[model samples]
Target: MKLDRTAIEALLPHRAPILLPTEVEADPATRSGRALIRLDANARIFGALAQPALAHELLLEAAAQTFGIVIGACPPEGGAAAGAEGRHLLLGFDEVEFGPAALDGGAPFELEVALEQTSGPVHVARFSAEQGGAQVARGQLQVFNG
Candidate 1:
């Protein structure tokens, strides 16, 4: 069965994480689907201004547990949504840490996080945060499906 945006959203447990549609236009010349997603690392939407630690929580090693949210987007038409059904494997945070926030800066701080496909019981991925091209914090998370 194919999954649409609504169905996918329902399956996802993360309530407020930012979600960006991963879509590509079909090529008229070759008539290819062009559905494969080429995500620009800079396009990710950070947590809202309402919550201060929300964004930081995503970068923490324990973030997957601290806050719930899905990490990646399925194909344009939609593929098997990535997430768990009930619980996830925990990747405790130890060395990851975010720098202090600036009062005048637009973004509290910029972060670079990555999620990799895993075959474990939990949804696992790698994450990092940086400022002025300097690595400020980094960690891994295991998002629960339920």
Candidate 2:
């Protein structure tokens, strides 16, 4: 199912400024989805969040939040650890590759992702961040149920 902005916000723990999933199209049955992220560097509060809008780094958090949406679709009896709490943690990253800038000025990008339940409460999510028809970054994120 495709989640609108309202639904996406409901499934994610993050809020504006830090919230990266602007739009997400997900298939809960497969624990896969694509998220459109538009970073707003200006949304910072009192310069706390001020920094260069780095797409490669921010893409990782976006991918994790996107995976959370699809994970919400799994039933309690299923292997998904997220359950109904909508609580999950991004543990770490692995095999991350930083590529040339797909575009300057922190252009919006879409990340296609798939998640696998590796073990109890542990999940591995793979994602490809693309912008301007070119890939900006690709990596796997380690996640676990909260």
Candidate 3:
């Protein structure tokens, strides 16, 4: 299920997308997605995603997971028609991190991501996951015209 540039563009809002390198870490659960890494002004890189650690064959997997998602043509305005103004496009992984066992007490873990339109000018967007009243994880992805 490798999506080429055309397929990705058709599925996303922006004509082009900034596909970062695929990163994966060992987890007890089988959930899978990419890890977002960021660097500060002092040139220190930080992991935006969080994963639980276990003692096993420590290894990092490098591949796109089955959890990535892309949504185009967002819902319309409040109680309005389908073809309303200001549509939204979203792209990110649904579940990221995996192994043979579930995360802490069978609860799903969340990862953070950042997206941007970075060709000439860099415009950014951020996303976070929440359940009930607690925050879970976050992610980001970039889109552009083809």
* lDDT by residue for model 2 (27-132), tens: 7667788888776642354555432555456677777777777777554444545457447777998988867764443467788989855687788988888878
After TM-score superposition, the amount by which residue 131's alpha carbon in candidate 3 deviates from its true location, in angstroms, is 2.4
Ranking by TM-score: 2, 1, 3
For candidate 3, write residues 4-82 as lDDT tens digits: 4344334432322233222222221221223331111111113322323421101111012112222122222244432
TM-score of each candidate structure, all chains considered together: 0.39, 0.80, 0.23
In order, the Cα lDDT scores of the candidates are: 0.37, 0.71, 0.28
Give the runs in model 2 whose Cα sits over 4 Å from its true position.
Answer: 41-53, 74-86
Q: Write the per-residue lDDT of candidate 1 for residues 6-93, one digit (tens) a residue.
A: 5434643353243321222222222122111111321244522422334344334223322222332332123343432344445454
Q: Name the lDDT of candidate 3.
A: 0.28
Per-residue lDDT, model 2, residue 114, is 90
Clashes of each: 2, 0, 17
